[model samples]
Target: MTTTFDRGLALLGAILDAELGSAGYPGNAQLAARIGLDQATVSRMLKDLAALGLIERAERVPGWRVGPGYFALAAAAGDSRLLVRARPLLRGLVARWHEPAWLSVRSEGTALTVEAQLSHWSSYVAAAPGARTPIWCTGPGRALLLDHTEQQLAELLEGVEFIGGGPRAARGIPALAAYNSADRLAGVVVADREFEHDVVDFSAPVRDPSGAIVAALSLAVPRFRLADRTAGIAASVAEAAGALEVGAL
Candidate 1:
């Protein structure tokens, strides 16, 4: 017979594996169905996994993101334990901007939403806290790429499929690679094809106590709607990133 921890670990792995394979992360019910378990049971295991410091469970309105912290921990071990450290500031940014904000990590060359915050106005499929977006197609993804060396960036992009038309999205990888520290400006545009609009995504890197760009903070504004609010948009996202840098994340 399997021990409780072993069973919980197995169940947690299934939920996270399914999440990784999905276009976006799935809800508790869907994860339950996939694992042939009940939602509450899956939730408990998820909580346990988080307790073990092996995973993160993002409980959002539409769904929850079961991300790979166990793998993250395994890769970096006890050194990179500050993911939970960034949640509150991300929350504050969402509250201040009344918009969706996210904390995401690049896992296995794929960008994963490890945490999310929603403004009161979130009713669309745009930027749910737990949703996964392509590193090749998103502003956060591009900003996240800026921290890599030329070879790493090229290798990371190799054979990668891209999604686009976001308000901040550049026309190609060359544009993305052009992002600089000089402007004190950073972010990307992702085409909001689902809503038939462009979403301006402004992003900045988040470093843990070790100062590694382990995650990013981003804001997605509707392009047509944000023409008048550009400065405020930039400031809010920059402020959010700054907040994370000072131990917020």
Candidate 2:
């Protein structure tokens, strides 16, 4: 039986799907059409869900996206052992540095955040699990791609448009390839104002027992706040990544 609760859940799931979609977030009209509901009904339902914190208005964007509550529920229900193992490490990163920390894995040529530990600051970067970012640009994103060969990188990035990031973001595959080469040598990635103009990210790849790159652990901070502290922050991210790798296995 199609109950009211099921319909609400369906709406929430649809919004989350669009939030993670490469095509970008869907507005009310689009959501209504997709769900086969009247625009007025979708709007009322969205308002109710937003009030409950299941979804929210996308920041500076034109549509609805899943909220922290949704992620909290999803995390509780998820069965991934790695996510279970990573939560403490991410929390530790936040507790130590007072910065947001994230655990992300490669998905469909993008980096999909699977876990996040947010800082307690009144103003800080807002990232939630299920958010996706360009694999060629962001810190965790680049770290996730550190093991790919030049040809493999090219193949994966084929048809991808390099757009909508801060000034330092890689503008092309060649730039990403160069950055990855350097990251491979250094064993970490520092995305300085690459994903967002005011934020910087330090990340390291997390490898499994078989030495395969499975995820990336990252710490994000404001660019101004990172002054003269880059090295220590990068080292901490790398160390935490190592711990997560062992703990996950």
In the range 17-43, model 2's lDDT, one tens digit per residue, is 887887477889998888788899889
Task: Count clashing residue pairs in model 1.
Answer: 11
What's the lDDT for residue 212 in model 1? Answer: 70
TM-score to native of every candidate shown: 0.60, 0.71
What are the clashing pairs of model 2?
Answer: none
Give the range of the ten consecutive residues with the poorest summed lDDT in model 2.
121-130
Residue 96 displacement (Å), model 2: 1.0
Residue 26 in candidate 2 has what lDDT?
84
What would the TM-score be for candidate 2 when compared with the true structure? 0.71
lDDT of every predicted structure (CA atoms): 0.60, 0.81
Best by TM-score, which number? Answer: 2
